[model samples]
Target: MEMHIRSLTKPDGRQLRLYSRHPIEHVENAPSPFPDPLHANPHMRWHPLRGEWITYAAYRQGRTFLPPPEYNPLAVTRTPDNPTELPPGDWDVAVFDNRFPSLSLEAHHPPETIVPTMPSTGKCEVVVFTQDPQSALGKLPLAHIELLLQVWAERTLQLGRHPDIQYVLPFENRGAEVGVTLHHPHGQIYAYPVVPPVPGRMMQIAAEHYSQHGRGPLEMLIEQELACDKRLIYRGEHAVAFVPVCARYPYEVWVAPIKAVPSFVELDEEQRADLARALKTVLMKYEALWNRPFPYLMAWYQAPTDEQWHPEAHLHAEFYPPYRTPDKLKYLAGTELAAGLFAMDVLPEDKALELQNVTVQLEEPAHA
Candidate 1:
């Protein structure tokens, strides 16, 4: 597959990222003309959450890596305790409203009342962690990682309480491989007026699982995974982080509450700290294996708190790092793009053990 490099610039003069493309689909083993309704096209994107599908067959021409326009620069930065100066405290993890939000906090989302409408009405914020530009969570000390987890749990809890807000999505975009523009150690929160699709589908499946098996779907997965011990990444007291049984990526890791709380924000102080330890362990392992800046997207899924609709939503985090082979990335091509199915090269069991047994040295902190 051919590779190309591109860049997207922010108004602040900071280039958000350099786009290095890789052929997601390798047809060396497939038949000449792939025959299936799923592969009717070469590349397409189904915007499940937005209820739309976009074809990227012309991805090679000119629209490969055009970055979206900058939204609110003011919202991306921190709101200092004192408006006249920089933030006073040194924060390892912090939560703030996302500047480039796909959703908005609708003061009042009265039933459409228009011809065309999309649910861009929600809230999103960026969670900036250290002032340093190149700090990754794995590099942070265990104590700092603990504090960061605390911030995540707190934000989820506090944001979930809003009468207008339904779901709180806390996610982080790491490395250029995953389209993460900034090098700063930070994440984001999207407080939605409605539950997003992935979680929504999960809620549907979970409800069905509960009705049929008399237990949560994730509960079923945790049981099978723990006993199987194949995809288990890190098993801690309060939480269990592991790659999924049918992993979609090379080293995709998920963190779930073992106690089966409805949401992550519901986790107590101790549970939050345990989550921190488990997460740090996963990132550290990934770094050790890759040995460089291992990139991945870390996302938290919570039950959208509306007046009351979705009942079976269980909170969890998804890590979808595109890096399958070292320096190689998995792009969403024909299969994932056209069809909903996902294909991965690495075995989950092997990746799990590799991450579990691997270790790394923490970077020393700078003295103030």
Candidate 2:
């Protein structure tokens, strides 16, 4: 499949990169309406106590809220009167620059202040999973999910090559409880100029473990989970998904490649397929657990792009579902928010058993 690429410079000087498997003529004939001009004033402040960068983008406050269905911006445009972000046509997958990005490549210069600060020179792109806005990721066919995975790997490789970007994160926020402004079934890719805090701390721990032992911490964790067999959800040939022994959320699941890989770009075709299947299985189980649309945050943890290549760093995806029961949602309060400590109500082993009991249902292809 040939992907046609084009760049458009928005009125606010931000560059939008468009990627589509369809012909360029299709996109040109039905160009999407330009979004309202909005400038991003992004800057990163040094957190002296935490020793991490704190990004602030004031313009994001005016982002589109929960608009009505008729005005869904992420939907594929069907008519010129209702043009969305995507051009009017059938597209297997589409990617474009985010209208209200928290970070941008064309961010304004940082002002002089007593505290140290730097320009938030990064890129944020939206990954539209399907042409149909209402379709969810788990409901889509395995082929479409595989295509989405390919796009993610491509973007990871492309964004990681940038000299300024230090970390490339691909993630999804589903449902309003996860703070999703749009109801579309989509995800996002954030290329951070600096390594984020969570991954930074993870790399540090992994490095310490590697120095103490020969193998990486992720490999050891997978082996331990397999040995226990209680937390193992799905074990594929190339990938494995299991609930961590120390899960932070009630239904938290970690999916990782059996063989250590630093980033999605390193995964081969077979590994990608296996990872997709493992991911789909976990997502399906989540919905089946409550027999409703599950709300969760899917976060991909990949190695940084900088020269500090930690051999112990392994690629993984973590799911943090808010629901602890059918109607109960886990809210992060005092202990978790202020003290940075998690208190789980359900045991990881029991949750894993519950997920393992749920059967996987195969669905027909929703998109080509």
Candidate 3:
């Protein structure tokens, strides 16, 4: 049987060729602006990277996952005098593996416990963007923000050398409403022996796309988006940041290199620095939205250490936050809890324009 695909343009203008039997239903003002569940949005999305299309449809639920207030307690707090205990100050970007780790670091195939016996060894790290009690990404200086970007690239290269690790996912979480467990300005990394489901699905779809169409998925996306510039947030010599047409989250921004490269280690120094500058610029814009520490989840996508089938992989990063208005936020409800489909209320274009900005105040330092 032949597979049928439907091409559609999202509200923001990201071109999508959704795989389906019949043509996709295009509503006049669908997902119409209202208080909808998170799952109502696209379960996954794709873009041009390296030479393939990567899918992360199932992760849309993550945008509005239930909040466990217990995670961020209000018992005793830590002060500048002692940061290791109770609470932590906003910090310079710090890198560390995930503790509530979804994947293990070393394969211990001894007995049965939570998950089936699969050697799921991976790495997770956090990058604290500031050291102030009240500081957000937009409130950081160009120097400090640049430093954070440098650290992200440097860490990606360091983890790519791990023999057992296959994929390295560096991401951040902000805003208590977004279900952030910790209040610090930080992001995390997950280096796994196998690529996650989302990226894997994208690689699979790209395989089909490659067999039928002779071009890279992300390559095409870059060309198409650059030509339109509707959702195009910013473009640099090596990178482009945009809010995808079918964005699952309220304000979702993806930034990736124009040319397909699967790993940060493959990026030249100048290219890496360019990425850093772009990151700082974009993040500062995120903070300027509400002048508070806006909650966000940022991640860097790179090749798995085991460079097998790398032709199917592409490299990029993203920032997806659920905060709709400065004070208003999107919450996860029943539909999203049971099913994986996401429902976004506001249009992607308005959300991106609302969040994107250049004016911000930096967090104070010792000299200040």
Candidate 4:
């Protein structure tokens, strides 16, 4: 697969990196109808009480909302009448800089206030999985999924190498229930300047576990899940997907590498393929469970770019679906929001059994 790379400098001076498997027709002076306002002055404030970094991107309030199908920005430009983000052509997979990014490459000096604050200096990009806007990741072929994984790994490695970035997160928010503003089948990659609270806490806990048990928490957890075999959903050669014992959501599944790997870039070809299969199985089960499209937040947790924090970290993908049943949606109530306490209605083992019994019919081709 020959990939042609090109760079486009937007009118607002933001650079968009374009990669495609086929030749890209260069547009000399394409008019950008929606020019960036250049008002994103994001800053991170230290939450002294919670000991976490709180990012404030007020400019994101004006981001593209639920637009009509004709105004889908992620779709390929088929005619001059509709000029999307990508060049006017079809693409297997395409990635470019996000127009309304949470963070920016151009660091800014925050205001001088009593509260501790720093400029949100990082990067954000949109990864378009397919040219067909109607398709979802679960419905894509295995080969396409594998290629998407490769793209994720490449982006992780590239973004993690930046000195300003501390953590690189690739995540997808599917369906309107999951707060998806766009209907297109795509994901976003966020390179954070500082490690987020959840991952930071997890890293600390894993380090403590390693100090006591002399093994990573992820490795131990995987071993225990495999031994119990009750909550395990799908066990591949190199990866495993299971409903965690203390699952906060009704159908939450944690997909992790059997081996102790720090990030996706460490995965070999076999491991990547196994991960693709494991992810597909879980997604198919979700689709079958409701007999409708499954809305979920697919989040990838990787090790921090700092090498010192690498040994204790492990790569994992977590699915947080809001639906408790076909018509019911689980909303984070007071306890969950105020106290950070989760209330799950279903037991993990029972949910696992229910998912295991679900029969998934794959109508799409497995491979390209």
- Local distance difference test, each candidate: 0.60, 0.80, 0.55, 0.81
Model 4 TM-score, 2 decimals = 0.90
Give residue 127's error in model 3 in angstroms: 3.3
Q: What is the C-alpha RMSD of each candidate to the true structure, in Å?
A: 14.5, 3.2, 17.3, 2.9
Candidate 4 lDDT, 1-368, residue by residue in tens = 34555567756565655555566665443224366547567888887888877777777886664456568777666565556675554346777777677787775987666679999889888888887788889888876787788788878888888889999999999999988968788999999998888998898898899899887898899999999999998887788999999899999999988988888888888788878888888988988887888999999998998645577778999999988888899999999999999988889999899999997754443342
TM-score of each: 0.71, 0.91, 0.65, 0.90
Global Cα lDDT for candidate 1: 0.60
> How are the candidates ranked when ordered by lDDT, highest leading?
4, 2, 1, 3
> Of 1 and 3, which scores higher on lDDT?
1
Clashing pairs in 4: none
Each model's backbone clash number:
6, 0, 36, 0
Q: Tens digit of lDDT per residue, candidate 3, span 1-368? A: 12233333323322222222234343122111112322112111223333332322233335443435443322123333222212232224444433234444433443343423344455545444544535666556655655555565566666767776667777766767667756655556666666666776777776676666665587678778888777777677777778877788887887777777766656665565556555665677776666656677777766566656465445777677877777667776776656758888878777666645455333432122
lDDT of 2: 0.80
Q: For residues 97-183, could you state the per-residue lDDT of candidate 1 as single tens digits? A: 333345545323322432433435555566655545556777777666655655666666666777766677778888887776656
